[model samples]
Target: MTTTAPASGAHAAGSAAPGDEPLLEISDLDITFTTSTGHVNAVRGANLTVYPGQTVAIVGESGSGKSTTAMSIARLLPPNGKVTGGTIRFGGKDITKVRNREILALRGSEIGLVPQDPMSNLNPLWKVGFQIREALAANGVAQGAQAKRRTVALLEEAGLPDAERRAGQYPHEYSGGMRQRALIAMGLAARPRLLIADEPTSALDVTVQQQILDHLDTLTGELGTAVLLITHDLGLAAERAQHLVVMYKGQVVESGPALELLQKPQHPYTRRLIAAAPSLASRRLVSVKERAEVVEQARTTAHAEAPATTGSIPRSASDTIVSVEGLTKVFPIRGSVPWKSTPFTAVDDVSFDLRRGTTTAIVGESGSGKSTVAQMVLKLLEPTSGRVLFEGRDITEIKGRDLLALRRRVQPIFQNPYGTLDPTFSIYRTIEEPLRLHGIGNAKSREAKVRDLLEKVSLPASMLQRYPNELSGGQRQRIAIARALALDPEVVVCDEAVSALDVLVQAQVLQLLNDLQAQLGLSYIFITHDLAVVRQIADHTLVMERGRVVEQGDTETVFHSPQQEYTKRLLGAIPGGSIPLAGSETIEVEVDTELGVDAEAEEIAERDGARSPLGEEPTDPFTGAGHV
Candidate 1:
């Protein structure tokens, strides 16, 4: 094991030599978690380095030890987890040998960490500004009114809108992207030498993700902070990082320049990852004919066997399964007068149709009323006005057995697999619960049905005895899909279903959905914030903003020739759209001197017309509504 110290003095930006000592180094690293059953080796012989002002990305699937390795640097590992053998050096000091107090002091002052899942990381009760102030206070950066002012400045630097007003808001009040930005502000409050961002943008929208990354790149460059980004998005890694580290099964499989590794991957796992990434599946939306050709080509190239055929279930473009018309949902907000309340329209005059055996995607940022429409269609929530017709029948007024029948026909696959699946239920029980509820079969027959569903979702029958906790995020989601299909539903509502998954798992899940639709002639109302996924699976698209349908058309027309400005902005927000894998265009990080605080405030006021670096609005007013 070996470690190297960072350069003692300042150096020109992006001028680090291959022979120059790294700011942080890790060698022959190994980590293990002590569990009740036994000790699990989490990391093995992992090696990495981060030079001054360099952005290095570690890319891998879940449980590949990327987060484990990065968390070990800050000693943020859980009590049961420990580094068995490794050398972690930061600025000439060996972190593994540092005392508790020394490591505590080194955390925010030397190496700042932006943890994954802002909803879990941020203190829900405290104000966002207070949290930022706490970070500043810990590092002795500012105090009193100065600290408050600095917090707002940091928020603005993070590209957050209404920095002053947002600073006074609670964590629950902010959107996922806003909460993430708050965390980033806290992480960079003291301007640490190295920033360890663990899946920082996983929960964010594409445009917000790009903006946050851009701000980090610019600010970190000015401060000369080295960055170690841990993520599963291979396209993001390729686009942002100078160097790439590929991890598989706790081992460093490959490491090299980002573009070189992406273009010509040396490891089989890396190649498989690239193939499974949905963002890299197609650069842009294609015509239906083109999509079919591409799918056929992929099938022929990847598999020696002939492609599987769809079932003989008949479906046509005009056969509408779920029809929504002039749907509106309003909630009453308590006003200053006890007896009176203000009406808040969550969904207003929204209309869309889900055709038989085809996927119709509702695309928008958070709070754009996508999920509200889905809930209305599913009869989970009644609209304040308008109607939902299921199979040419009004389901809005249906109740009792009728609603139960509707449940059997329309099922949902929610966003978080961890939250959706019951932890106490085994896989067999989880899948069979739906069958039991619908009285489809006897106990013995239900078990058989569960086993069949397991096979359908591509899970082994042996997993029937395993509990939800025993499964990975991908596996749990597969179980959820199996459970949803237990009663042979005709329509499925997938609400941000694959947003949290890694690219590889997301691709597999999307394929599974496509296959199921083909096999059973099922229709889908896919609600999501990801435009990239919409381009892949949707047959038709509906663009929503502030509870209204901005645009609706065939997938090809909507994506290729968008008639709405919001739709165009969504398309433009896709990361790596302009940047290519083979290109030599580096990430430019020049600070914008023209962007002042008052100017940013003014931009916030006129956000609807103003544009981000990607030529989109900075904030969506409805971005916080009805999200998972």
Candidate 2:
């Protein structure tokens, strides 16, 4: 394999000067897809360049042509997609007009790709080691025992623990972060000159994401490979890339140094993106005065509305709506022996309380058992041991008509809007199904209710006729929220609800939730891995690790002066946490010192320095397993 010289520039580390000839450059690039309607232009005269050993990022929302542009460089666009205009030069060669044979040869050996979703990208039928070996053999890197040896080395370099054992496992057996690392290992199997990582760590925890990026940085540096990172996260882009390319509606709105663009974004769309990111928002909770005002608003609104003749009304803040005590869920793992299985504890004695009209967020990395606890509280799964009290009644024993009532009172907005909403149902029908099932009103009244719900979510009534496939990710999520509210649920369980949305859309959806809470006196059980999100909306927080609540307290107290080492590490891993922004001098103040923990508690927490349940290894803070 060959490599290009390092980028030259006056800017900070990793950036290239514009005067230098770029290793890969796209000029006046245009891409279009043949849709059922007509030819849809996905990329419009987009221009970008990547210098040797430089890290450049393309930041934009969905449908902004970021992925389309990256795919065009590798000739990996979908069947319906085609490059109509422009020149794509790679290493002084025009790849656009290259023959099919040449294009195939140039892909893995010269330019590698790490797709968005590891689960979908990886072949489920094959072991991870076999896949890496195949990539090596295809690229003429190695074969036989030599290839197997190289595969283990790649896995180890990608930061997977026990690489020899993990390589023999299927994709489903590994955690999400581990799967992503496997994908990265495969992408780097051939040691290509350029690596295109598309939304590489969007679904990963902050700590895991940081670790993956750090590994990528280290390996790419050793190999002198240029990196073109495509993502929707501005913070990640700012933290990792030297140059930032801002895209909007298939056009390049702005391109410059990462810090410059972040500190003082010149484009209107770029400004909007930064403003909408919760991770970039103020870290501290609302002041006491502000919270009081919000509570007053909710009280006035609730009083003005007619009292519910049926169903439950909103309780006061002091009232505990849901109490989880000694919650434990143990799943039996079957071994090779017939009818022999060992118990694997998923949730181990976790406990928390959800106060009325308040938000209690459960946060941790994937496989931390946060979802299991949530399922128990929502009565979707029965706890192996412990009790869940909803309105002073044990939900486990509730059945028949009473259980149905619980379902109406506690609705759920799942993580994947695409999967949760039925494709066959129209937006109006989707929202009306819950109302009809509950026998809330007549046909005309149900139709009116759907419209009201849409309006509440800041969606237009015209969208009522559209199907799930016809809407954007943000729009589909809103429809899901509308459906959840159609039954007038008091406690809405949001399970990774905003994880898939773009920064701007995520901010809108979060604000919508807050507004609805204040207006309807609704409480929430928000489960997510993004601590930045937890800080923005949660009043109280429960930090989970290995099926147990390692730390629990008010959001401000936990964030400002965390007692646990795991909590401190989690807080420190936030992207751009230490990077100085243009307008903002400091990251959002997570707690007011005056109201925060006293000196005594801080000393005790430091002295204790409790070890994490997962482990105390210096690997990814999200996953305790260290790099081999």
Candidate 3:
């Protein structure tokens, strides 16, 4: 990594890069959060810069204060965070002293932000057109038809289809990739000079994530907008960014060129992070005859283990886990005004199978019916029209005792582990409750099992007593996995499960999942928009768009030689091949989320108790397919 040779006595990373002056300069930036326990100095004294038209990435694990640093620049940090000490200068202006209005203008017009999740970023109530107008209006653009016209042009510019039609639809109406495009459109509406993307592609499937990243790269190159990318994915930072910033415990542990920092990272954190991300080489080694076996298995309806175990996921007839046929989901557009609009097809004719013990990833942007498919598979909602087979039996209709039986066979790990579990419940109770319900053991035995599960995840038993809030992002996620594993179902549906985690944590979690799969012979439906992750873990890949499969094949074939332009765009968008960072040899997931055990987790109302008749945890949080 270039940062390995950053300015030492004279060329400290805080210094200017060679001759060019920085466009955005931050010096000795110190930020802290006032927590009840004490003060969490999220961003310690740190220094960094983004030169003209240069992209600088702040890479770190969770609680590294990387996000805190960027958010402070835009004055977007939460109420608890304070810029304790620092000087932020943009275009020679002291932003620290700038008024709210000027800072606001600088935000949308001079700087754009592509937030983490499309679902939360875009307004569910407004149309793409209105949101664009709102953005422009905030940037001093006059409101009216002119703004509407520009909105359509911008949508088309961002590569959305039927811009005119999409303009009138709500956030729920657009596909996942399309929604991200719309959010990008909103950010670029006023032609900002800089773009701040916080985990922009984290929640997407690999294909859609790539497209969005490619679009951003093209847009920035064309408009010369400086980019400040904050992420945990080192591969992404290395692939797309020109410069790098590594943070740890709110400190600038390291900073250098993206390529340099990745290839020859000096900091231990940087090394660990790069080591966590999966690469083609590592994937090839771990998956036996991965490519050959995937094609062979894809053609052969009967599932069985591949001859060579180097390039593919293990297979079994019973492992021919989930199969979907002619799935259709439509939503009625309810308008208060009479004859205002019509219903639309959200997902149509989606069919695919998740073979046993293998990872069949569903790749797409947001709202592409990926999540809808997952929901239907989990029988969270009856498919608008379709059939779902679990272990060769229709699960869509199964209920009562039979349905409970199916639930035990399938388990899910959600995207945001923090939000998946309850803030109130301790990890101990959370993981143990499921064990008790399944009649696996009594209170003592269940507690021991919970602790054992935590140990398997590399967490201490003491963590089981603490609430979700006390743990780090990666740690909380570990708990979530332990809880999911309590049932040890035949199939696991992970919906963007590792997206929110920092790169190292993400890697750890992915590795954990991989280990679990090998040890337990588990089957998984791994849904994500991360190509990097898909390339490493997926046995077979299915690319989705507008609620349909645009491409489906073995992982290597699909990634190395994509058949569809959309697929190509998605692959190209991933921060791969370019970044020369150390890559992971395993798919281990380590993350923390506030979502923990809740009323929903417990079966208090039902006589069956919390124990799923299927002997598994219950959640409709989009694990059958991946969604944001």
Candidate 1 on 113-216: residue-level lDDT in tens? Answer: 99999889999889999999999998989999999999999999988888999999999988888888889889999989999999999888776787788888
Q: How far is candidate 1 from the true structure (C-alpha RMSD, Å)?
A: 13.6
For 47-121, candidate 3 gives per-residue lDDT tens digits of 887876777888887677888888888899899887888898898787987888888778887878888788787
* Residue 58 lDDT in candidate 2: 91
Error of 2 at 57 (Å): 0.4
Q: What stretches of model 1 exceed 4 Å from their correct place?
A: 1-20, 284-318, 335-338, 581-628
Task: Return the TM-score for candidate 1, rounded to 2 decimals.
Answer: 0.84
Model 3 stretches astray by more than 4 angstroms: 1-20, 97-114, 122-192, 279-358, 362-402, 438-440, 540-570, 578-628
Ranking by TM-score: 2, 1, 3
Off by over 4 Å in 2: 1-20, 283-296, 299-318, 585-628
Clashes of each: 2, 0, 66
Question: Relative to the unseen true structure, what is the C-alpha lDDT of residue 485 in candidate 1, on a scale of 0 to 100?
Answer: 89
In angstroms, give how far residue 108 of model 1 lies from its true place. 0.9
